[model samples]
Target: MKVLKFLSVLVVFAIIGFSYWIYSSLNAPHAHSKTNQYIQIPQGSSTGQILVKLAAEGILSSPLPLKVYLKITGSGNEMQAGEYLFDSPITPLEVLGELNNGRLRTVKLTIPEGFTRFDIAKRIAKQFPQNPPEGENAVLNLMEDISLIKDIAPEAKNLEGYMYPNTYDFQRTVTTRAILEKMVGEFKKIWKPEYADRALQLKMTPHKIITIASLIETESRLDEERAIVASVIYNRLSKGMPLGIDQTAVYIAKMENRWDGIIHKSDLESNSPYNTRKIVGLPPGPISSISESSIKAALYPATTNYIYYVLNVEKNDKSHRFYSTAAEFERGKAAYQAWLKKERR
Candidate 1:
């Protein structure tokens, strides 16, 4: 009888213990199941508020289990506030892990070669709102206030040509100054000491070389023809002839926001110092963003006495035919004009 009674008591104790284990396991809070869901913890929310919000979002099965687990794991105080995307069926533990790790999506901004600072600023404004004011004029004003490129070119009114074009990864909250600094730093890295010496050897300052390079960049898109174009500019300077580049007139028109894609006769006759057709020397400032190859070409032009070049209409390979005199250039220009008319027709 005594043995049977002892066996019954042991069986009851075992049953009680098993029941308690099952209850604890079922009530334990866990991450939500893997499904597409957003878990947001607003800024300035307290730990308790965050836990409550998580529970209400169905990410936590039970707030008590989550609270206890957090306290036990010492992760209750490590939650960060941000917008988080949770994969479906994620557990509370997984959410906690993500929060602790501070994971956020990154945005990419690509600045192509020969992009002006105005273009770059527009790109930044689209990607990062924390950036400075919008539009080319507003961005130019902000750049002047920052003095980013003033030391390099004290005469420059804006950092238009200095903003090297490249791909950049930034957070949504990144500032304009930070983005500009990265681009300028990249430019500096590419601008070697030897290049500076070469500029001096050519009787030009780094600033002047950059300014001329910008003009060459705007004139030609063919990398192989940059040196030839550079020679044209140099030849014109040596002969005291006006460069007569129409892009300069376009730039002047853009400054006044009066550009209409058509260069008016009066625009060529404008008294602006930037009017290369009216001026006998290089423009007072850069006309556009310059590539490294353009800069190199400006520093070391090809050994050619050819003073003029026109688009090669027959080839259409982005190559230009050079001529030492006006007659040959006129022939090339006539061919180009015929081709343009045919295309338009």
Candidate 2:
């Protein structure tokens, strides 16, 4: 009787211990990272292989219990292959659910309006470390595939101005080429057929319209003032005067990869076709990403003869004072210089 009782007590303790372990496996958080972590299960990986990878990634502390849980729930065979994001301190059940549901891991990448291809390249390089990692130059070369814009910009040297700026959703495994294509696709949605007609009426190529729009995009902060800025550009171009916008110098700096926020005298003097201060008419292409508002302004410039604009010092807004003559421009220039000097002091 004593031996039988001892055996029964042992069985009871064993059952309790097994039950506690199962509960812990189901309820306790398995992921060890302080931040969200990712575990990729390749296509056709077996349940055992998936568990082992989860263990290797430190997402699962002990694979045995989770493995048993998956098997018990008949979820083992349901685990699909893709990049899976695991929230830290997530329960094992949650991990299993995410994998079973085949929720693809996606990343949000925002390309701001007016960002150049140079800026876009750097951002892409940083955002995706390596689904076969690519460098900035490799991505830039990808942008040079002008086929994406062949219909709209047949003469485009590259896909610089056509990369529409907006928030984009990308699967973590998306290729670099695929990403650029999607962004260009977004731009197509905004580039209406009517806009192409407008461009023809203005005697501007679609590419040149986008280029001028890019100039207006970077020149003004307020939407209402973009038309005014576009008018200034048109007046300068009509009079056979240099567009002389300083941001073109910044654009030149970006293309050559030396952009440091300040325009260098060397940049102004360098005879790059993108440099508007030295070259008359539009740059070789769009200097930055173009927005639809700026595109509209380029298509229908306000009927103003004003050929110059200086920052409006009185309002301290990004708004500018439009001038029609050299004398008016000189006075505004002097005031701007005085303000700049005082600010520097």
Candidate 3:
């Protein structure tokens, strides 16, 4: 009977000791001094890898105890992959909790309005460096997956302008293709049912509407000006006149992979359907990402007789001076050229 009592007491003491050890380890501060620097945890990393990483970073004095605790709590398989930051020394339990909850480190990526897919590809390439990081061209090639919008844009050569412009929180683990998919998904959500009906009224397909929206987006930054710009495009199209948007020249230059910042005379002279200055109607596809305002402008254009517009140089706000006659447009063009020369000098 005495032996049995002693054994029970011994077991109780052992349990108390184990509990104290765990509590101490969990509440103890780590050795990390670099508060600003984040620890990048790659995807598919195991608990063993995590522990080793923590020990190497001086985040843990002993990895064995944490590993044991994680296994005991069934959290060994729950460590999420992401960039993690420990602002101050934290307990192993806290770190484990963070990992289990999956507070992934993310970067705020804003794809600004009027950005082309080429521009987006550059930004994606810069953000994500794979084992060796993909180049700009590689990223561009990934964007060639046009199946995302096939039903909407049956004639889309590639995902040139369908990647919607918006701010995104991208996880480090997210692939370049994943980002492109998300952007296009965002575009799909914004495309309302009424937009199709409106397109029907305008005798335009959804793809053509997107094409017009891209033109409006590239033509001017002003929300108020988008409708007027859309009207000018419509009026020109009705009259069998060239769209004359210089941004289309930039798009063609990018397509031919010869864009060098300056719009070369050869670029303007190129006879591609994308070169709207030479093409008599809408481009074969969108030139840049379309925003909601630009889309709305394309669908609900204001009625106007104005067939020409030039930058309002005196205002310098990217505002335009609209004209219905060729002579009026010529006067604006000369003034714009003079201002351009003065600025260049």
TM-score for all models, in order of appearance: 0.81, 0.87, 0.85
RMSD of each: 4.9, 3.3, 3.7
* Deviating ranges (above 4 Å) for candidate 1: 1-46, 49-66, 77-83, 130-136
Q: Between 1 and 3, whose lDDT is larger?
A: 3
Q: Is candidate 2 or candidate 3 better by lDDT?
A: 2
The 10 consecutive residues of candidate 2 with the worst lDDT sum are: 30-39
lDDT of 3 by residue, 58-100 (tens): 7777887787776678758878877777757787877777777
Best by TM-score: 2
| Rank order (by lDDT, best first) | 2, 3, 1
Question: Which pairs clash (backbone N, Cα, C closer than 3 Å) in model 3?
Answer: 130-133
Mind giving the per-residue lDDT tens digits that candidate 2 earns over 120-142?
99999889869554788888888
- Give model 3 RMSD, 1 decimal: 3.7
Residue 175 lDDT (model 3): 80
